[model samples]
Target: MKSVHLTEGRPLAVILRFTLPLFLGNMFMQLYNLVDTVIVGRFLGENALAAVGSTGTIIFLVQGLATGLTTGFTVLTAQHFGAMDPKGTRRSASNALMLSFGVILILTFFSTLFMHRILLIMNTPAEIYDDAYRYIIVICAGLFSIVLYTLGSSLLTAVGNSRLPLVFLMVGAVCNIALDLLFIPGFGMGTEGAAYATVISQVIAALVAAVYIGRKMPDLRPYRDFWRLDRGMAIRQIRVGVPMALQFGITASGTMVLQTAVNTFGPTAVAAFTAASKMSTLLTQGFAALGQSMAAYGGQNYGAARPDRIRSGVKAAMQIDVAYAALISILILLLLHPLMRLFFPAGTDTGKLMEFARPYIYFSMSCYIPLGMIFIFRNIMQGCGYGFLPMMGGVVELVARVIPAAVSMRLGSYLLAAACDASAWLTAGLFTAFAYHFYVIGRIEQRIRRGRARMDASPPAPKKE
Candidate 1:
């Protein structure tokens, strides 16, 4: 009901405003994971930290696939809304709920089936394997809650009501933290408690958002027609969603390989990689927010046949993301010591873990520019419905991620782990730049020129002079 129309506005100001709530919301989401990390690390100890860390790649594999698939629904919702087609927007929104359910439902059944094998594939250390298994089990069972929240937040964002989701997200995150303190030390559930904390919090967020959206947003409200299946919408969703899912799956697979490489060094490397990864994710919340902004911005203009707005939006996103990258890099470097303290306590053994993990955060922070570029370009193009080149770039990133991690293993686990991330971001950024500039941007320009041509050929204007 409080949706913002992004079709005509000051590009940067509107995008920044829209992104602010989304940014804070994302940090809250990431903070949910951080709460797990910090609590598990403190209560269950560093090895416990490694157990949760070990599950990162596989969990991301699932989440990434879910996100990629559900993203189409977001784009479609935004497109219809931007075109001012309430009927189509409602139809798409209703269908999006179904689509979201279909994908995550299947994943929930299949992930639990393959959970152990997935861990095995990651080459999880024997010391932490059981711990990792228990944690992932709870998480896998409750993944639908996450899917529900992701779908709801995405739909709300599409309609330009990012603030509402942020409010609910904070509520969920606060619940998670309280539950973490209650479950872990209070109840002695250890790492499993942390997992339950995460799942329950996510469930709360999902249910709250769903109920509110059903009551408030006309496009998402359920009715008799909402139950009817639309073959055309379903088909369009698959055609778009499948490629996006593949790109995500492919990229995540590369990270899985890199994770396997990290596992080779035993629990210390896994724990370190985990801490670095949490920082990397949290630090780049701004960039992720910028990318999401571009996705919504590009989608709306494209739907309205105003392709000329896209280039300007892209330029603005690039500028914002680059600034974000620079700032995150500096802050991480400046606060490296205190930041590391969040996950590891002060001690000789903990200090060893810090040595292994802290470099990862520093190196990753330094490389934010390329990583930010990757997200911004890929997401905006995906929003514009340009799937092929973006999908191909995933393959480029896959090769980049794996080869370096594998080849650099001889240099030691830390370098090998950092190499995987650095190469993946750098390679993916280059590939996306080529696709975005030569293909995505070019087509939008062509469309804009043609739109202008039609305008010029229309009836002549009367001159007041």
Candidate 2:
């Protein structure tokens, strides 16, 4: 029951305090994914790793959509909390919870039934298609756990309670790791075992999060009054959220296109791509967590009508981001060989895998600063009730990733897939920068001007008083 203390005067201190727990929590979440990969790689074998990797695009699409919608909920909750409207928060939260469950159930059903068909549409190769289908089917069937975990975590983050989510994530990660060992090695379950472990852990985390929310924050909890559907609120949430979800899905679809390109190169290349993406995500988690913190910070202040505080928070976030980006980039470059070895091992064309990945990592570094800016910009917009900009940025990324990948494949070079990723960052960064200028800077300046005019006009009245 520790308080968030977000309304304190020191914005940086407040944000950092809030962000640290989130950072740790996100790291554990990333670790859960990494551990799954590691167990599958070391114990289950390369084909197993490929099996899991093959579903990367689909997972990103489904999970990213859920995450995006959950983000919309978070934005609404933070705004209501900032405005000191507990009843509104409760109503919005209830609507969001109901909507999320319904959407998740629908997605779970479709994804499960068409898992194989979707993979074929992605042009999954002949040799690996069966394993990929097996892996995806199991994962999709357990989509509720994934959705619930995200929904719970998003709600907690929205209310400025990051620590609880982190604790739950740690418990889940531990459970996942233990289950991975038992199911994969002890029971000889293979890739299906790994997928099962993941879903079970998700269920545990979701349950823990739900219990905490119900017990601790009674004021913010959904009451019976809030349970009946409010058409306007539901529409507003979906309007804000669906675009964001589509944006992620669109962007992930581009990745699926890229995955198709990588698959064309064979399983070795697919494995390499999978390893690189996982490693990069591991590194990126720190900054991503910071970005989420900024979103909450910005969203709350924006709702409270404190534009200055949002500006200050963005500056502080940028400073932290730069330092983190540099450190992570250096670590990635310096330890590239060792890191690859850790995942791919020595005997299995590790050298070739590294060769394929080195350039992509280097290119990724070129855009880290811009990438950081994108997070700041997008979060700022979301905080200010300008959710559309973030969604637009997602669409820009989707287009950027897809076009280059398609053109590159036409010319027969896998390197283009890496190039497409970098291009997406550039496109997203530019759009986000524009949003900053128009929405943030423009609004703040207008506010300042109006404030000055009001002050000038009020002087005569004060003198008379």
Candidate 3:
């Protein structure tokens, strides 16, 4: 029953309230990942670390599908909520749950079946191939938990209850860290240990969220009769969800190609990249959180037929994102070495690691502004029920990233390979921004005009006195 209704408040305050929990939750998730990397690099050594890192894109490819689809599913739910249609909201949520579960099952089956082949295709080094296989296989087998957690959290966020999900994530992060220490060092489970820890933590979070929704959020619970598929509803969600899923897949596919290129440089480059990527991910959490807030904000306003408010929210969000990006970029560059040092042990030689990773870190920080804008516009458009354009933007990004990495491979330059992400963010940002401005915003303005016209044409009320 408790939710932040974005349709009623100051846009900036509402969005920031929504974003704070998301930002903190994301930071915790990143910290957990950072700890995992640190533990592996220090305890198991660089080859073990590289093995885990090599699987990042493959993991993203699978997990991103779940995230993207679930996100798409929730957009309709958010809209229904904003329209104050309880039945519509519950129906949308039910269908989303069923669809997401089905897709996750298929993904898990294929991913686990071909884990070794995927690693091989990524050009995983001979020394770390077996370890990578071990890690990713466990992760793939447990994809169900990830789906459950993502779907549940997304459902809650859709209704503007971001705080509970953050609490669940914090609990999961703590559990994950505890398990990581116990399994890796105490039980000597190696990379598989890290994988197990992650999966178990997700399971815990998912179960807790499910229980909470069942007991506390009766508004979201669909009746037994609502379980049956509604073809029209399914179509609506799929219309929005599938392109979003493909966007994640396509974007991840590009990262896979780039990862393959990185692997060719051998284990050291891979490890350095892994560390740098983790750091960049940490710094960008603010943007990601802000973007998510906009999706909910835009969705609710759109359903309420308040297109003008959506515009105002996007502008406010962009201003926040830009300022955060600027500040974080400067801070990251300042602390690059100190932060990079945390990935390894107290006395490990980081000379080679720094040499390979520093330039990549610099590129990431320098391009934060564009990257932040990419999240803002892309998510807002998706919230507005325009998935195809964002997916096309992802295609542009795929091309931008893959081309540079491929050229880097031919030229034998890691710097060139490192530049791929910056280029992708820039190109994709421009594409998304243009699409929003030229197409989506124009459509939104038409909605606003119609709303105003309807009001203007209405008959005046008689005086009560």
Q: Per lDDT, what order, best first?
A: 3, 1, 2
Per-model RMSD to reference: 3.6, 3.7, 2.7
Expressed as tens digits, the lDDT of each residue in 396-462 for candidate 2 is: 8888888888886788887887777788888898888888876765775576568668878875654
lDDT of 1: 0.83
Candidate 1: segments with Cα more than 4 A from true spot: 346-350, 410-413, 445-465
Q: How accurate locally, in lDDT, is each candidate?
A: 0.83, 0.80, 0.89
Where in model 2 is the C-alpha error above 4 Å? 440-465
lDDT by residue (78-99, candidate 3, tens digit) is: 8898889889999999999999
Candidate 1 clashes: the total is 0
lDDT of 3 at 352: 81
lDDT of 3: 0.89
How many backbone clashes are present in model 2? 0
Better of 1 and 2 by TM-score: 1
The best candidate by TM-score is 3
- The deviation in Å at residue 380 for candidate 3 is 0.6
- The deviation in Å at residue 180 for candidate 1 is 1.0
Q: Candidate 1 clashing pairs?
A: none
Model 3 segments more than 4 A misplaced: 447-465
